[model samples]
Target: MSRARAIGCDGGGSGARLALVWDGLRHEVCGGPANVTSDFAGAVAEVSGLLHRAAQLAGVSLEDLRGVPAHFALAGVVDERVATRVAAALPLEGVVEEDRRAAVRGALGERPGHVAGIGTGSYLARQGPDGFETIGGHGLVLGDEASGAWMGRALLKAVLAVEDGVEPATALTRQIAEEMGGVSGIVAFAAEAGPSDFAALAPRLLDAKTDSAARHIIVAGADYIARGLLALGWKEGGAICLIGGIGGKYADFLPTQMQKALVGAEGSALDGALALAMEQDG
Candidate 1:
């Protein structure tokens, strides 16, 4: 029998991951900074190269995988125009759905509920018997108001206030700047750093949880998440699953008021991509 093949790729704001299935088995490859719309051609090229290399490693040529069904869940892929642009760049035959859809499907297994992801970015999507809708994740600089990036930015602001002798804190202020390689370094890093970098500092900030300022940042971040959930108009009993690196990692730190909103999740966009591929193949 011919070896049935399929591939799924999800491009997050921070990084990208690909899962390929041949026959009954699957393989995954790590990629970098392939958020389809924000990075567009660059992201597509990165994923394309990643898939090509993965196939090669599996002793399959890129040409051999031509027309093999593929699925791509892309961050910053908001409208049809962006999807169409990505399609033209990648020229891969498969499905391209909203990144949140993939995240929801993967996390909730397509069950009706709200899945909130707080990674380098932040977003909440609600999938019901009728349809799916989302809020947040406009972008790292403008939107993603309560994401890891938001946390990091808030932390920096707090540190700056301390440095300026405006609002002193119990925790060390310079340490935050040092973590990002000093203030200048932070600016330089921002020029190239992906979503993960901003979120990476979140854990460090949490270490000072006893500091009222730090706690304020965390609570404030959770409030943003709550607003997104409120936007979905989810019923009191509706399931609210939390996904994403930050969401899973920092769930314990969310305000008590928002804690009741969480339902927890088991999978991610990666799993959702694989599941979609399987369904399409079948």
Candidate 2:
């Protein structure tokens, strides 16, 4: 008989990762974006390809996945309808959950706590005995207030402010204008830039650490996150783990009260995916 096996997939707007657990061992592989809500077919293909790669890395054949349970924690799968559509496209027996749940589980395990995931996107989630509750993560336009994408957008706006003389022309603004090919270039980029494209500019803000504009933007975003924690019922001295690309950077800027609650994540979203897959297997 084949040994017990399962796959855990974490799919975000920027990329997807697959973890294969079998015979007390685990293997991982990376793939392209898998936001099924945005591009169902493309996401499906990316996830499928990643699964195959993961299986191969584990010295298993694609056929070996027949009875294996797979759990997918994906972005853009907000409801049952979207989950159903994504499930129908895959050839596996598994469950699909929102990325927030996965991040919570990954960061906190079964412990009742809170997680603030701030990367290309941002979300605040709390998990307790009853279940999980999430706030923010409405995407760049609607929310994601403290996310990298948000910071990038803010930086772009500052560039515009400089051009229009609405704000002082700081070193940060001058650099952004030059890098983006001046005000006209920014206008063109904005016309077609996706969230990820804007998020890509976030590093520039970090690089411009000494600039007053950069400091202001970072602090503003941090304040939004701190406020989110309070709104989500984060109690004083409660455990809160920050996860994602920009999560750590925001830590220093968070209110001192909130900082006391910050703790290291026990694991990653991939681990959470695996935990969910194991539960399903039983």
Q: How close is candidate 2 to the true structure, as a TM-score?
A: 0.88
The local distance difference test score of model 1 is 0.75
The candidate maximizing lDDT is 2
TM-score of the candidate numbered 1? 0.78
Candidate 1 per-residue C-alpha lDDT over 1-282 given as tens digits, one digit per residue, 9 for 90 to 100: 223577888887668899888766677898798877567778888889888877876778777777777778887677888887787777467777667887887888867888778777788888878787887887777888778888877787777676667986555466666666665766686678665676777887767777777888887877777667777876666677878766765567655545666676757788777677666746
Per TM-score, the best of the predicted structures is 2
lDDT of 2 by residue, 1-282 (tens): 223577889998778998998777889999888888888899989988988888788888888887787889988898999998888888776788777787788899878888889898899989887578998988899999989989999999999988999999899899789988998999999999878888999998987878999999999998888888888888888888989998988888888978888899999898888877876735
Q: TM-score of every model?
A: 0.78, 0.88
- lDDT for 82 (candidate 2): 92
Q: Alpha carbon lDDT of residue 40, candidate 2?
A: 85
lDDT of 2 at 70: 80
